[model samples]
Target chain A: MSVKLTEDMLKALPDSRGHFGAFGGRFVSETLMDSLMTLEREYLRLKEDPEFQATFDKDLADYVGRPSPLYFAERLTREAGGAQIWLKREDLNHTGAHKVNNTIGQALLASFLGKKRVIAETGAGQHGVATATVCARLGLECHVFMGSEDVKRQSLNVYRMKLLGATVHSVESGTKTLKDAMNDAMRDWVANVDDTFYIIGTVAGPHPYPLLVRDFQSVIGRELREQSVAQAGRLPDALVACVGGGSNAIGMFYPFLGDESVQLYGVEAGGLGIDSGQHAAPLCAGRPGVLHGNRTYLMEDENGQIAGTHSVSAGLDYPGVGPEHAWLKDIGRANYVSVTDEEALDGFRKLTRIEGIMPALESAHAVAYGLKLAATMDKDQVLVINVSGRGDKDIHTIAQLDGIEI
Target chain B: MSRIEGVLKALKSQGRKALIPFVTAGDPHPDETVALMHALVAAGSDIIELGVPFSDPMADGPVIQLACERALKHGTSLRRVIAMVKEFRETDTETPVVLMGYLNPMEAMGYETFADAAADAGIDGILTVDLPPEEADEVAPLFAARNLDPIFLLAPTTTDERIRAISEHSSGYVYYVSIKGVTGSASIDVDEVARKVAHVHELTALPVGVGFGIRDAETAAAVGRVSDGVIVGSVLVDTIARHQTDPKALHQALTDLLNPMRKALDSLAQ
Candidate 1:
């Protein structure tokens, strides 16, 4: 059921207490209940105000580089032969990945709430580094929480966060990975509610966060609205982005949710393959359960414990997604598909060699899906690809597979 | 009215407090859980909240976590817990037994099926740790339609609006968590408990039960002086954790732990 997007009415609702069609609500411990409630109230007030939007927009334009161009890939299109492919360069944002957009907005909101210390959890280390960079620039005390496994894998990003003047703490709980790191970060925010703000990476978490992060990341969609019309004289035939915790996909898909004609494709990472029992394809091989305060399709065991997940890209290793994606998948508004690790590496190489643009491993997953779909569609058909982040961080991960040095 | 209702109401009539004890079912063994529940009621429990073991219990502290681990090791489940309640129902039907746990098993079994089974087993209510009042719209009605009370919780930091929301949805009574923490903690906030109880009383006439950190008789009596019920958990779970293999020692340990809080509540009752 696609509801007509009334900008005024929909903006007013905003998951009143984060109930996105029974997917999002506050399901936390007693200690977090109060802090989350307080933040929820404040965030709603700020998001509804026009001045906050103006300030956010101005910062996005002048500071974070908004209105990121839609560059059509002519050579790549001929090679694929189906549809004309366009890239929305969010990777060109100040901090490599699309993470900075939301982090900058949340850090400001944190400061607005009179919070001094910022705590964050990172999986791919992009979010942690971005949060540390923004917090350092904003003069806030920053503490980054990393899963021990992620710290071992993404040690360079860990060092980058520390170099940005943030204290990085390795969390050793649950799976000793992203989800566990998020839990520990939440524990800290709960314990130190008076002075801390949790700079969540994705459009996941309890009330206001899913809404807040989406609002901040909406710059991707809003800019696409103006840029796409200017370039193609109309909206693209489809909007495609990778979905992990689903920040970038949401950032690209939401503004087009009301546009019935635009096909939306969310590419999930098929690490080895769907049959491997390790891929983080929740929509394809999962059930609805409550995790991280939202009821969504989660990679859960028979006992409902958070099971381990795998994806070659560190950013795409999460088991559950933002609750909004769950609702979208249920309603059939967006098509959630998958691409194998081998296909993603091929896309990463193709984009680099052909378009001269190095794409993030997370973004390469989307490019890989486009490569297959574009070959089958008409030449006049337009496809908008959200280049989520730059591929500099993934050079190491890619090197292990095959050398991309030259 | 049921015997447990009559007993609690009569105690309340005298301006007495309700001493509600929480014991994990089948901790160490099922038979010991039965003995412990009976002893606690005899010793002076106005109501009983039996914790159904789950694998990933997020809100629980170390003591309760250990209790759940032990119970799971011995093959305890929601099915076995209901069976234990049915056995208890044949003897004493008055003492209200509320099954407190997470929402998955109940949701997995289907709400109506679980409600029917619980009502048939003589369960008075349920308190799912993860299901908040907002999401309990469908769930609370499931129990209420089956004549089973859906007990809700009000935390120390719950706002006036949330307190009203929870109060409006509650059935049997409201569980007022004493501290701003999980179950089994070192300190009890007596002031916050009184404040929350008063806050809930303003919105609804439901009895308020305080839990999470009441360790001894003094804390129980103090909380009882202000609230309608005093719930003691971790300490009882700790009792089972200490006597893992010895059932007699576990029973004795449970009895010893209950006697003091029971004595304190009994004094308030008289």
Candidate 2:
């Protein structure tokens, strides 16, 4: 059931410690040389230090509400015509999204470094809300860069962030959206690397981020495994998670990467269809290129400028994914697949109507896969998935699009 | 052959380094754009990287970003940068002029069309920061058709495998970043830079010109001692922006930075 590759197996590489299976490596500008070196030193110490994990573990439990529930979705499983399905409800956590888990860990770590301000950029507003929530709790000065378009679409989220006491900047340049927001955040980081901590939300940035964000989000997999093994009396047959910058997917997949029996599937948003220009499935359609912080699969133009992307879920409406996932797709370690906007919309309706659960549109991609894959499998097979966030934030857009069609 | 190969050819025969100077087109004012190019070549710049201003530059640091913002505010576009290149090429055809910029405007104008315009405008090379070597086919094929050098960045963090990868497809000299972060920070470890430059040299005879954190004339001198070229960015921009209202201070600072490094590289051959 495991796909374990010993650390000694990877020792031949120059950056064995940095690479994960075939993923993760430093790809950044020279300005961050000393800073990255400093971080590498600090992270190396923290990796081996029990006290550091102990502190993080305490924050996960006491502060962020850890060990999120894994509940059986009996009705939805029956409707999908497959084995019993279970959901690791990360949405039920504080901030109504799994992003809180990473935010709390990073904000705490920022405090450990005596950093006074925490800065970030958000696309869908979930990460911004989570970061702002943590900053409010920790009393750190929080500045969030949001795209002007995102501010308009996710008005509730924008207001929520402002209510949480974050200084929100609406970026007006470069498509006025997530990628632009990220550029603004990077600019801010470049200017304030001295006293501020850049709390990146996803696993997409240069080296340490893909690694760190995964480590922070791995609690979902860890808890799901512990609870499922205890109740189901065995590990689940497969682990499924949605990929947006691939952070949540990496989190859930990291704890189970060695478990070969636990097949992993990363579902991407196929906005109209893979053939349509509107999709956000970078791994499926995009070629390898550098974006944000590192080289990865990105939706780029002939001139390599990041092109516009579309998804039913604002969060998954990105042009690139983390490089680790890029490597994972290459190695065929984890299958990267897509769920069309229509398919995800159906999943959204099924979860709400059958299981009495409303999933964030981003999470609906995984749910869409669950429904499709369930029909092909035997009834005895069990599947576990991450219900990454709640649907409250997505309702306005869904309403605007008018409930699921076909 | 790439224009960079010509510079490397000269360096090999003359036993000299490529002194590359980057100046923003339409910076301070649109008229100064071509004038600065002529002044830089006269000041001993072996290659001139003329930056085309983009509204959003995620990869640039504060200094270059600000320079770009100022350039953009003045309506500096690819067309204007090409015009500057054409004007400069009239007087200085030997010195290579590389148009360094983000990818949006190029795509906005269409790559094939942009390449033709650039070639007609006498531009020799282009360096798009966002376009990694892995995806050079995005625009490189078109640029190659027009005989334009496609410059790429290889940072200190780039592995030997990556350097080989970058060098295989990269035309022009590799823009070797001496540090790990953004554009302008402070004091670099020259010993570490020497080690990284040696590593970069192993992959390609394509002259590796080091940039980022080489801010002062002293630091430029230090870099010129080890590498084929030294790129001074923030210090130059700061000097220019400091006396935006007065051109004399800008000239004074430019002379201050380029003179000592010119002397150091001159002494290197002796």
> Can you write out model 2's per-residue Cα lDDT over A199-247, one digit (the tens) per residue?
9999877566777787799888888888988988888888788998988
DockQ measured for candidate 1: 0.27
Question: RMSD in angstroms, candidate 1?
Answer: 3.7
Each model's number of backbone clashes? 1, 14
Q: Score chain A of model 1 by TM-score against the reference chain A.
A: 0.96
Q: Which lDDT tens digits does candidate 2 get at residues B1-270?
A: 766688778786888877788877778778787877776776777888888876557767667777887886677777777878888878877888888887656766777888999999888888887666543555878888888988888875566776887788877788987765567855689999998898788778788889888765677778887788888677777777887777766676677777776777777777
Docking class of 1: acceptable
lDDT of 2 at A222: 82
Weakest ten-residue segment in model 1 chain A by summed lDDT:
A5-14
Pairs clashing within candidate 1: B4-B94
| Candidate 1 local Cα displacement, residue A261, angstroms | 2.7
Give candidate 1's error at residue A79 in angstroms. Answer: 4.2
Q: Model 1: per-residue lDDT, tens digit, A322-403?
A: 8888888887788899998888899999999999999998999999999888987888889989999999887778776675
TM-score of 2: 0.71
User: What is the i-RMS of every prediction?
Assistant: 2.9, 5.6
